[model samples]
Target: MASHSLSAVRKRRRRRAKTLLVMVGLLLLTGAGGYLALLNLEPSEAVMRERCTAVVGTETYDLNPDQASNAALIAGVALRRGLPPRAASIAIATAIQESGLRNLDYGDDAGPDSRGLFQQRPSQGWGTQAQVMDPIYAANAFYDGLLKVPGYTNMPITEAAQAVQISAFPEAYADHEPEARAFASALTGYSAASLDCMLRSAESPGDPSQVAAAAAAVFGNQSVVVNESTVTLQAVDRAGWATAQWAVANAKQLNLTSVSFGGLQWDRVGGWTSAETEPGTVTLNVAGAVVE
Candidate 1:
């Protein structure tokens, strides 16, 4: 009787052990399946590539890559200045005329007093030599004075710039307006992605990531990501879901990630990650600072 009882106890233990092993295997399989689903959830690369191509072909001026980059810089500066798309267009057109969007180290004799991207004169109250050289500051100053002029927006590009710049060669800005308008139209939408550089160069002082964060603060928790060489931002609605289907849809132009909705609030969870630890899974929380 004692031997039979012992045999039954051993059989129960073996069954429990087998059951536990099966459960663990099932759990691991489920976890792996979930991860694969997440990976597959990312937007199609081919689609993104096509969209990027369209943006480059349509929005950019016929100038070479250097000129396109310069145009983007000017647009970014104008956007930072809180200028409307029209105002940015006018500014770019003026720069195209003044320096062909190239930041010339030397000023032409026609405007020896002219300098920097906009060619504002230091002798004029535009600013000290240092201030005018800084594109953001100079552009903001120009827009500030430009906005104060009566009917500046309604006036021609030359008139608008001359109202602020008081340039002797007022008509020089007129020819550049069409190119500027083309740039503005391409960059002002929600679906409009980041402007690409024909030539890669050193990073600018005004990084687009910082700009996107500022825009998000005013606009709500929009998704910002660095894709290829461009910084993309997607606009989200009150629920934080992406409102546009693609990057070329809205007027507040920025690159964007594929839309995600109904997931755990990613912002609260923190930024994305590829870790396997608990609490390290992809969540919306802001990324924590790393130690040096």
Candidate 2:
């Protein structure tokens, strides 16, 4: 009996150790810090935005600004790449399973090379240390692999993700499918005006150019106008929502005071209401910090 009990104890310890390794291994601070750079950006008396929500039919998913922001980027990248909506959902589901939509720089001890949002490994073909640590580059790399898989759209979300990421727990990705699909649909402009944000007022210097640049980074060929306090994205209703939601996601980071699209306005603490903008423009207003 003693011998059998000792063997069981050793087996449990090994399993625990493995779980620990994958669950919260070494913090790839460099990769994490760089990959999730946006998480640390935008310092101001800028009041943080409240929970951002994505509503699809009767289902709703509420996420923090950072998570919503990252999800927007993922969907934007997919659209920019000309991939289908299924691809975006798969990618979003994978990220949700791996990092809960927040870019992380943690990996298991046994395979400590993994880091960034996907928990990708440097040892694998993900990218160089610097590349994987950057969110744009990392997301692109993930797409690269995902695109290579044949019929990925037809596969189960978990199986599709497993094809791209040979994760130890291959089944984990399925659990996030519903939320991922909702977020992906909103961010992809498939479900127009389904994403909303509640912002708080703040006194922080803002940059229209920075928001423009970030939009361009995700959208690549999309046109954006940045002048003084206004950053406008000239798009039709659906695409405009994607741009408008992106602005809301990054509101705190950019000190955005208001985001408007198709005559729907979202200001700091103002929530969603009516606007009087042009018929085809999504505009964001950011104020210069009120110097005390």
Candidate 3:
């Protein structure tokens, strides 16, 4: 009778152990399944990129090719000239109000004294007709005067512009602040590469090489190299590409070099190459060759 009871007890312990092992295995399987599901799921807004065009006074301006390109230029200029985001926003707003991103040859009657993108007065030492008409030069000069204003960032856009221009109608500048703020938000790196431009006309001639060159002028040299079906970037900062062209133009100030795009695998050697073999692990590459 004792032997039989001991046998029964051993049988019960064995059953319990088996049950516990099965439960642990099931839990581990569930955890792994959940992890795999999360890995495969696509995030919302993954396809969205930045837009470069802005709306001003009920008019939609297509900036993708030219007007859009100016945002980077202006941002780069402002940063290089040591102006803050507030100043950049104010300048962009002033440009929107004055020229609508178009460098005009003529000014309205109210702007006879006005010229160039910001409509500076020649009499006020802003610049000569030829000099004021130059966008880069005009931008630099505007920033020079803007940097002199005390507490400009704390002031309203209208007040800030008034301090710079002292115009007869201070309220006019106020109306353009929203658009300026939006442009400034993009320029100041608040949003990551959210400001993009779509080519309005199919005939619009945009050279990626030229764009890249122009950007490199301010930002620095960036290259995409492929080796054995792998792409590699050297000394490039991917985040900086948001303002790549701007950085190229202000290269002297930013001292930036290299940006990569469109996915080449990167490794620790400051080297990026295409995956030579199937990824042993699953991978995701977002816009501009970035792996998330």
Candidate 4:
């Protein structure tokens, strides 16, 4: 009887070991499969980030897509209205102070009625809340007030901005002068090849109507052309670069793959290239974009 019991015990231990081995094998296989799945996923399947930069001389300014886009519009509007580079700098500084270059519809307890990029108070004749929310309108309104300050272009940025903004924190605008200057120089075409954006993923493609409207909203009527596969803009030399760079600044959002003018072209993977192209018109090629 003792011998028989020993044999049975040995058999039971062998069976348990086999079962544990099978489980360990299964676990290893499962882990390997999961890791392989992760490796197979596309880069764009993950949330991708976009960035823009303005490099001028020895200075560089980096900003997110939204901030870059807004900065472009602010400076573009300044150019469209014949505002000097100094005016653009002061405007950009003021925007940096008020809303961090974003258009906001709310304000602090002191000026709860204040709104827009410049934090203009609707109750204080800055126009309707809706107008204040419009970046172009608000920028124009800011310029209107800014122009009223005598020789604002020649005044110190903080003092000029203070006269227009009348902020309780008047000196805050001074801190952003360097960054604002870099962005303004690039967007206003005073600094060539100074601005660019690295888009991490392909975005929704460009829309003809929307592109035209967006450009018109800032540059004012007929500065850009609406087309099925292209949006042409009337840019002369550096002005062309300003618009091309603006398209690049908006590439991620607009799914812009190509911005071409003169003998140069900017594409998604490779940046600017020397491509033979027509003069007098800057063509932005809109291929493989989501039209929405």
Candidate 5:
């Protein structure tokens, strides 16, 4: 009887092992099917590859969407304050060195209380922790410090940045000078059609009012025409390009489908191409709507 019971237990264990093997096989097959489905995804369902580039002369600088957005805000603030492109360059370099143009919520050992894009420390009277974490406030504060530095516009990018930042590794700012200058030149409208963002298709319809409000926040009140899914900012010359490029830098967050100015159009897939857009207007179109 004991021998028969032991044999029964062994048979039951073998059946369980067989069941586990079948389950593992099914899991592997399911995983492969999912991968195959991903491989055959439609163009409309392609994964997002979002990035922006600033190309000026022989130099080209690439920034991920978040960094590009922050860089745009910094340059826009400089434009609003009537500061020169040099000021934007200095500010961009400093931000790149200190925070890689990201609005960080924490700090390193050098500035245990630092926050935001420029890493302004609350302990040093930059602002309250909440205020320092605000990108707009942080950018304005950095510009305020830059403006206080006499002859900053004429100083080398590193020196100008160091004068305002007083960073421990002052020389690090110089390393980002080329990248900063390229972005500044394109964003400031000194180089037309020099900034482009390659992004995935917009996920949903975008709000034109929000775009207009953001543009106004950066470039001040302007002649704006709003349609179903488009907003035309009546700015000409370099200013038009500045507004257009600013829209491009912000395209990811704004869900912008296209930005056209000075007879050039930048769309999500086609990049920059010649268009019939008027020279004196910067027209922005959002996704999933008719654009007039």
Candidate 6:
């Protein structure tokens, strides 16, 4: 009777052991399946974070796509006017302090009629309300004010910005000097390959005509050629680098796949890399377009 009882006990123990192993295997399978599902459903954190950066020397400054776009436009205007990089730095600094590089349609209590990038007031002879709200007009208007300042380039950033803006907070412009200078240098073609944009895949097809128009708006009449999905501009040396970096800065909005110039190429997935291309030309390829 004792031997029979011991045999029954051993059988029960073996069944429990098998059940435990089965549960463990099932749990492992479920965990693996969940992981795969997560991978398919969501993008990694790194991939989702989109930003543009300007690395100057040992310091790096960052801006979101919107800010970068505005900064690029501001710098482009300076380039078109043949202003030095210092002028761009001061203009950008004023924009930073005034509207945070964004084109605002509203204004604060001090300047109730203020609008646009430099917070220029329509009442103060900056321009009409509609004109100040237009970024291109606003940028030109800001530069108009800036040019009136005697020896603006020789003045400190705060003093220069204050002279143009005539803001109540004069000292505040100094705070953005470093950031403004970095972006101005990169966008003005003084710093080569110093700007990079990490962005997600383009959401829609890009229009070549739009790209051509934007280039014309900022850089003025350029030798722009459009062939299928590619737009090539005749730019070289510092201007070439400037055009290339500007394309990178505006890539997110333009839905550009790649910008190549001066023996360097930039893409959304892999920042800037080396590639051989014709000299004295900057090539921009728009996204979601068939190359014919």
Could you tell me every candidate's TM-score relative to the true structure? 0.50, 0.79, 0.55, 0.81, 0.84, 0.84
lDDT of 6 by residue, 1-292 (tens): 9999999999999999999999999998788668645443234432477889998899999998899999999999999999999998998888888898999999965488989888888888888999999998888888888899999889999998888787899999999999999999999999999999988667677998899888888999999998778899999899998898889999989989899998889998647899998899999999873322
lDDT tens digits by residue: candidate 2, 1-292? 9999999999999999998877664455455555445343333313444788888889988888788888888888888888888988998888888877777777753277777778788888788777777888888999999988998889999988999998889888888999889988888878766787665454467888887888889887566777988888888866788778777777867788888888788876636787788778888888775643
Please, what is the whole-model Cα lDDT of each candidate in the order they appear?
0.51, 0.80, 0.53, 0.79, 0.86, 0.88
Better candidate by TM-score, 4 or 6: 6
Backbone clashes in candidate 1 total 20
Candidate 3 local distance difference test against the native: 0.53
After TM-score superposition, the amount by which residue 272's alpha carbon in candidate 3 deviates from its true location, in angstroms, is 22
lDDT of 5: 0.86
What is the RMSD of candidate 1? 18.7
lDDT of 4: 0.79
**Winner on TM-score (1 vs 2):** 2
Segments in model 4 whose C-alpha atoms lie over 4 Å from true places: 1-48, 287-292
> Cα RMSD (Å) per model?
18.7, 14.8, 17.7, 5.9, 5.1, 6.5
Worst 10 residues of 5 by lDDT: 36-45
Reference-based lDDT, residue 243, model 5:
87
lDDT of 3 by residue, 1-292 (tens): 9999999999999999999999999998787667545443223222333234444345443343344445556665676555677887888777766677556667654467677777777877888888878777778887878778888889888888777776777788888777666655555555333343421111122233344455445434445333322222233232343353232222222222222332333221123344443322112111122122
| Model 1 lDDT at residue 286 | 19
For every model shown, the clashing-pair count is: 20, 3, 23, 2, 0, 0
Candidate 5 pairs with clashing backbones: none
